[model samples]
Target chain A: MLPLPVLEKAQTELVNYADSGMSVMELSHRSGLFTDIITGAEQLLRDLMNIPDNYKVLFVQGGASQQFAMVPLNLLSNSKKADYVNTGSWSKKAIKEAKKYGEVRVIASSEDKNFSYIPEVTSSMIDPEADYVHITTNNTIEGTAFQNIPDTGGVPLVADMSSNILSEEIDVSKFGLIYAGAQKNIGPAGLTVVIIREDLIGHAPESCPTMLDYKTHSESGSLYNTPPTYGIYMAKLVFEWLKELGGLKEMEKINRKKAELLYGFLGQSAMFQSPVQEDSRSIMNIPFVSPSAELDAAFVKEAKEAGLETLKGHRSVGGMRASIYNAMPVEGVEALVEFMKHFEEKHAQ
Target chain B: MLPLPVLEKAQTELVNYADSGMSVMELSHRSGLFTDIITGAEQLLRDLMNIPDNYKVLFVQGGASQQFAMVPLNLLSNSKKADYVNTGSWSKKAIKEAKKYGEVRVIASSEDKNFSYIPEVTSSMIDPEADYVHITTNNTIEGTAFQNIPDTGGVPLVADMSSNILSEEIDVSKFGLIYAGAQKNIGPAGLTVVIIREDLIGHAPESCPTMLDYKTHSESGSLYNTPPTYGIYMAKLVFEWLKELGGLKEMEKINRKKAELLYGFLGQSAMFQSPVQEDSRSIMNIPFVSPSAELDAAFVKEAKEAGLETLKGHRSVGGMRASIYNAMPVEGVEALVEFMKHFEEKHAQ
Candidate 1:
């Protein structure tokens, strides 16, 4: 969901951006105004995340899935191998994409348990010669998140935190790169936020497509080609919004409070069940199931009628998921809980 | 620039899109509402372009530059060569990208003339063994356009119509594929509109990155992953607007009128020089230069103050370019011509 104020701001500036007499969408990517938006986005992200001066923050397109291919194309060439922790479907897809370019070792997997929890990853599991150890920090489909980042020894840790990037603080220096598809906690899709260390920028192979080469984008400051201009403008606003609200730490507080209210109700409710383990449950994506498939369907339908939306779980999970991202208010979570209680009282089996 | 109607439509629907109670940006690409948006966009484009039922309209991201790599990665693998007609910077970039994947025969080039004209591309100029013949239909910077599509015999004619697509009528069935970056006449940046024949769909090499593979995206209906949701939605609106405005032929009429108004003035002006040959001049982007460099600078600055924006010529061209695409109204052109007349009267000496 869009932040209301941001949408209003964009609406007011839809036709004319800062007296340029054109929407941000209409500005050339090479224009001074557009360059400022992109660079300002990077700087805001850096300020909020405490990203080191050495890290190159790229505003890219094609989402995290493209990054799945780009990461291997750019980095996995040197080592010809990478360790992948299969905690969920997103990681599995990343592993599958990485295999097209290099050898991907499954160092750890919670797939055996239907990806209901995060896998226990250790340095022993990592290949020392591996270029990077990859992980999906948050699983939107499976409703799991790594509470803390894994120790990859000297190997770089690459995380696809598509659903959880701005919800909490992360040490940017710890990972070689962190990529997030900007639809969840960020502003929109089409914009992929990639924060990669300087050392990780320039090792792409000859076969690497220029667009896939991190160095090309990093060197050009993500202006190598026409980027998602309006999306980047929205992202800049979201970044500024985060900063205005006292950054990620403050966001984490609100997120935790929101998640706790819903999770607390789910834990105590007799009719509902939280499928994820306590430590692995995502504050951003909360998936729960009713006692029966029919009830789960009914609950999803009824919730939508009552104006709580996108509550149906992913087809793979087959239940319900309340993806309470940064934009989801505590009141929204409370409303969901109240609806769950109302349904439970009426349809107590 | 974004069309006023499209931007206003997007603004009205910015927070809640068509009673879905969510921004188009928030909708899952897999959801029915978004499926309708993408498919609706395709159908509208198909209708507007009179595209054959055999063609697949894929809404993609990373702009036309991504297509530069993707085209060769998918098409140039087996034949190992593609004939490239270099008209301008965009085509040169495409040639550079295709070289990474296969041999690119420079069948013809207008680079000797600083890309002021489109080279004569005859059927004999195309290598029979070539995978495809690549041409940039419109040169945005050089202000040149192909008045007629080149015949490629049995070979596929691949054209990059980034600056011209949807602004005028073209026979879609005459080419194997046409890809356009949407920032020009289509909608906004980040969305690429690819209209490819069904026969041209699935021949990517084994080494192709999944994101770069046309087959992956085509088979999945451009939702192989999260697409540029809002951009596609905006494109859909633009397409609908085009359709509502009597489609491309009608757009051509307006575009032609606008271009004529500006070019007609420039042609007769004693102080200004039209750098391009009249036959090769683009109705979409028209570049003109004044008597001196200082006057050109003054004109651009004064034009900006007069609300004529982005009129500065590409540095390579070193003049003024008034890109009068479909979205540029005739009044805008009239205003520009009046300003030019006023400026001329002041500095005619």
Candidate 2:
């Protein structure tokens, strides 16, 4: 759980957002209070990310899934084709959504390895005629993350950094667009944080809905439509929390420690096995399999009884996953590890 | 303010969503728990609206402003032209956004009358080649509302009912599409409620962004992108509340009484005047101007002192306005009327 003070402060305000004499749910997006929240959140985001003058950061709704289509809509104007690296479910979804709009070239993929690792893709492999190169920086479902950023030379590079955003520092100037859903490391699910190069705006096809036009949204300050108000408000709080915790560098240290402790325990455990390749482990999601599906079911049931919940893996994959997002304290992972050890000992007999 | 029970219940859950052991804000949209919320909300909405089997209701983000563009993108494909009735700010926005996609004809407009009344347009006035007829059922800022639905013959009729949705009963079969922002009579500011006819689906202009395509969102059950989980949850609660209130029929009766009481005071007051034409006065929003802008400011200041807030009008139209949504009880409006009476007498002396 998050700290009591932080949680309670947010809870109290959720019932009544900022002095509006209304719940955040009841406030109007066209109202001055909401516009302030939207603008303030955007400004604070720029400050926290140190986004340079040329990058347009949009506070869009519909998560990174929407960007799966939007990135191609805006970037694939001058060029008919784009290159994509399929890292996991999210990257695959990006590819699927992009195919509707343009010709997407698969530059690299880890599908042969069940997406347990990020494929190594070099800049030379990227087609020069391709409009942009798309990549999913972190694969939440498969528990794999890119340890290194891909080089796209002068080409526009788009990334879905949903799970691992703000958990580590990155050179924002390197990519053309970096989009993240705000549930894992940022704040919430509804808000999609998009940082796009200035030149990437205004290139949407005429058939693109006005709301999906990045240039229109950038010009209107993301208030072109009613954005998720409370989500943005909470994101602002999370940004403040990130800043107070010494930003991404400090977050990276803690995330690394948490991942190492959990992975170290899994490595030492005789009954438990991690599916992902050793070097490609994720810092956000940690998925592991037991000796059998029956054992996995029993393990999850016992873990839930022990207050370790939602450890079930995606339906496509049968295993257990522990998503230790930014909110999941190091102690939470320690508790999970301790629970796993006791469960393993009992099952070993 | 909403009743204490409603506020407290939401507050309790705002800190932690169901079963996830984390705030709804922290849950991933792809997670099962959040998906349940989205589907549950959609189901509740369908139940409350008695939505027919042939209609698809989408819980989209970005509110009705997004729909201003989407409606044209989807429906405008059938014809090179569309007819629009301009009543106020929202209708004006719809007309403006539609202009980007196709030729828009103003069948009738209240703008010449200062948008103080709803224009009376006949089906014969609608162009035979027009794709659809668009109208704003209620104007939030200008406080004008359509007392009757416009007839569009076979050419589809689309309505932007953002402020007045679920506030009254209407034949669902009458509209090709009805879209609403959730802040007023639905749930929150971020989530948009769109009920589109089945036959109207799959008409995207080829280059439309998937995020904004009604057909894509409908087919995917609004999960084409990550939805606003907590907002949808709140909307579910609101939908249940509407059901408990005996649906929109009962809501309309109570709403009528509330609006009459407030308007009664405005009509009798020597110090104030109604902004919109009285015949087309909105049951939801009542915008009235004092004898002077100074008097309007003073009225709002004194009204806030009496715990009657948000009575200040929009910046574009300088006056005092009161928005009496479904959540605002008739007693609240009565209290406002009493305060207005007291203020008028005090200022008259």
Candidate 3:
């Protein structure tokens, strides 16, 4: 679980934000209190990512789902064809939304393999004249992740790291744009964090709505319209918490340990089988299935009674999923492992 | 000075929303906790608006600013020109944003009269071929309001009622669409409420972003993306409070009394001058200026010492403004009157 101190501080301020005598939710967007929260949240985000001066960090609404449409609208300039590598549900959704705006070329997809592994995309698969290349760095639903980013050559590289952001270290300068919906590893869901290169602004088609325009939101400091104030505020706290824990390097080590422990238990157990290939298994979401769907339901039901909530996998893929996000304590995982072992043994017959 | 009960309730839940055991800001959009919130908020809005069976209410992210663009994208179908009556800052912004999508004809404007009154429009000024006629029922920044809605003559009439929504009574069926940002009267900013007639849906341009497409959001019950959960929750409370106060008709009577008291003071005071023409003055925002900007600033500074906050006029107009929203009690208006009378007596010379 997340630290008590951070949650307590957030709780204290939730009722009254930064001495404004109003909850963060009640503060007016144009008020000085909200200005501090917005500026502080942006600054903290920039610091967390060591974001360069050339890249702009925008805190927008609609999570990464909306960005699926915005990315093509803003970046698919000079060419109608954009390349997308679909690893899971989110990536596929992104590609689907992009189709409405432009021609989306699926350079690679793991759907044929039930999204168990990230497909290898060759340079030949990508159109040389494509406007940009998009990829999902982490497949939250499928429990897979990209071990290596594809080579886009000269095209701008865009990645959605919603499920694994702040859980590990990464080279921020490599991608032209990176967006994460703050739910699993960040703070919440409504506040979407977009790290876009400065030059990508103002390229939206003439018919693009003002709110969906990157240039408009970026120019207004993500306050062009009223932002999700409390979500950003909590995200700022999460960033501060990450910094206190020695940034992403420490986080990466802890995450590796947690994943290793949980995956080790799954691999050694004969009662369960993982959905994703071992090499491509996600460090955040671990989806596993039993010999039958009935057994999977039993596993999830027993786990919830044992205090492991939300263990049920997505309805599309009926199974069990253990989401060990940044807030999921190592002890919590250990407890989950102990429970999983007991449950497997009890149901072995 | 909104009521303290709802704020207190919201303050308590700000830390943990509806027994989800986490702050509303921390819940995932896909999580059941948030799904219930987003859905419940929409249902609450539908109930409050007494929305007809044919109308759809969408909970969108960006404030009315986004609707400015989306309205034209969705409703300006098969027509080259749209009619707009420029009543205040909001309608002007809507007209400006709409120009990018379609031709706009300003049927009437009060700018020549310093925006102190809503101009009387003649049917001759309206283009019958226009796809939709848009107006801002209440202008927050200018303290001007449409005393009477012009006849759209069977054409769709849309309104941006950002500042004055839920403060009075109106027949929802008369308009094709009504949108409001929740900050002023409804609750807070970030959550925009859009009520659209059924026929207005499904006309968005092919290039419109999914998030800005009214039909897309309407179909998903605003769960197409992660909506601002806390904002919607607080807005739900505000709607409940409105219902408790006996709905909009009762609210309109109380609102009229508050406006009359405040306007009566402004009309009689020798040391102050109101910007709006007497007949067209806003019941919500009352903007007044002293002999000079310096005097206005002093008046504001002194008024704040007496616990009268946010009385400074909007930056566009340099003076003093008292926003007596639905939440503002009659006692607060009396207190403001007392302070204004005291300031006038001391500074009249």
Candidate achieving the largest DockQ: 1
List candidate 2 stretches off by more than 4 Å.
A1-5, A16-21, A27-40, A128-130, B1-4, B16-20, B26-40, B301-306
TM-score of each prediction: 0.98, 0.92, 0.95
Model 2 lDDT per residue over A51-143, tens place: 899998888877787788788888998777999998888888889889988898898998998998878989899998899999888788899
TM-score of 3: 0.95
**What lDDT would candidate 3 get against the real structure?**
0.82
lDDT tens digits, residue span A1-349, model 3: 3454567786677555666566776666788877887888788877777888999999887778788988998888888789999888899889989998788888888889989998997777888898889999988888998877777778888999998888888878878999998766777555788999998888988777778889988888887777877677778788888889898889889988999998998888898879788789889888888899888888888887776778889898889888888887899889988998888889888
User: Comparing 1 and 3 by lDDT, which wins?
Assistant: 1
How do the residues B143-250 of candidate 3 rate in per-residue lDDT, one tens digit apiece? 988888777777888999888888887778888999998878877566788989999899877777777788888888777766776677777777778888888888
Arranged by DockQ, best first:
1, 2, 3
RMSD of each: 1.3, 2.8, 2.2
- CA deviation > 4 Å runs, candidate 3: A1-4, A122-125, B1-3, B15-20, B26-39, B122-124
Full-model lDDT for every candidate: 0.88, 0.83, 0.82
Residues A1-349 of candidate 1: C-alpha lDDT, one tens digit per residue:
7677777788789888898778888888998998899879888888999999888889888898899899998887576999999988789889998998889889889988899999888888888999999999999999999998888989999999898999998888889899999888788889998999898888898778889899888888888988888888998888888899899999999999999998999889999989999989999999999889999999989998998888999988899999999988788899999999999999995
> What does TM-score give for chain A of every model?
0.98, 0.95, 0.96
